[model samples]
Target: MTALTAEGLVLRGWEPGDAAALVEIYRDPAMLRWTRFPVTTAAEAEVWVANQQEGWAANTRHSFAVLDDERLVGCVALKRGIEVGYWTAAHARGRDVASRAVRALTAWAIGNGVTTLELRHQVDNEASCRVAEKSGFRLRETLPATPPWPLPGHLHLRTG
Candidate 1:
């Protein structure tokens, strides 16, 4: 419901117009391979945006569209007050977009009363691990593969 900005990146609430871009981002093989959400169609993208808004309204999650100079380049979110997740657009990769967004979101969440935040990525996702580290999260533990999430992962924690 609120917009945040730093270092030329704007973190804002999702809008209906973002559906196409969301679909584009989701089309990446890596995106589909790493996350649970697979928004392959416009309708699915709409649903994804709607769900984000719904979560925000319910106070269970906060999702932001990461923009670079007004162009959507990624997303960063806090779920259930303790988990943080993010993805960068293919064009935005290597620009430190995810890390910067995570740092900004972490600060916002902590200021809003969140005491701790967690980030987890599949064990092989070294990029995510780097982002977590750069964003001030430290590796905590490794979680065994579960039913839905079929791969082992490292759990990183950052306390406010």
Candidate 2:
């Protein structure tokens, strides 16, 4: 769970030193729109990084800092029940970073005994749908809007 590479991207655990980079990428409102966790300032980003480390220690989450040749570009996280989520830096969008990172995570999870993985994104987020398809997560259902999840979304699943 140290570092995993897919295509030309590196998926590595989030480190405290990465707070600056986290703030940089998360400045994208598109990235903030999907999650309740918002990393704005350096202090906020530091807390976010700390939470990621805590998640790893608790074995409840697997959050990776995506890098392209050592430059931080995004984040991909897999929750305990196998739910997958991601966001690419504004500058890195349209480069298939999300799909490649998800695929790499799926491979690792399946190899480690995970049978299925889930991906969810708002219906209007067409880009996420493309990433889901590219990552081999098939559309399974459209979930009703619920608390914390503001809008109706598609749930895609990938089974080992």
lDDT of 1: 0.93
Could you tell me which residue pairs clash in candidate 1? Answer: none
- Give the range where candidate 2 is weakest over 10 consecutive residues by summed lDDT: 26-35
- Residue 14, candidate 1: how far off, in angstroms? 0.2
TM-score of 1: 0.97
Choose the strongest candidate by TM-score: 1
lDDT by residue (1-160, candidate 1, tens digit) is 9999857899999999999999999888888888788999999999999999998999998999999988999999999889999999988999999999999999999999989899999898999999999999999999999867878999999999
How high is each candidate's TM-score?
Answer: 0.97, 0.96
The lowest-lDDT stretch of 10 consecutive residues in candidate 1 is: 145-154
lDDT of 2 by residue, 1-160 (tens): 5689989999999988999888878778887887688889999999898888888889899999999999988888989759998889999988999999999989988988999999998888999999999999999999998878888999999999
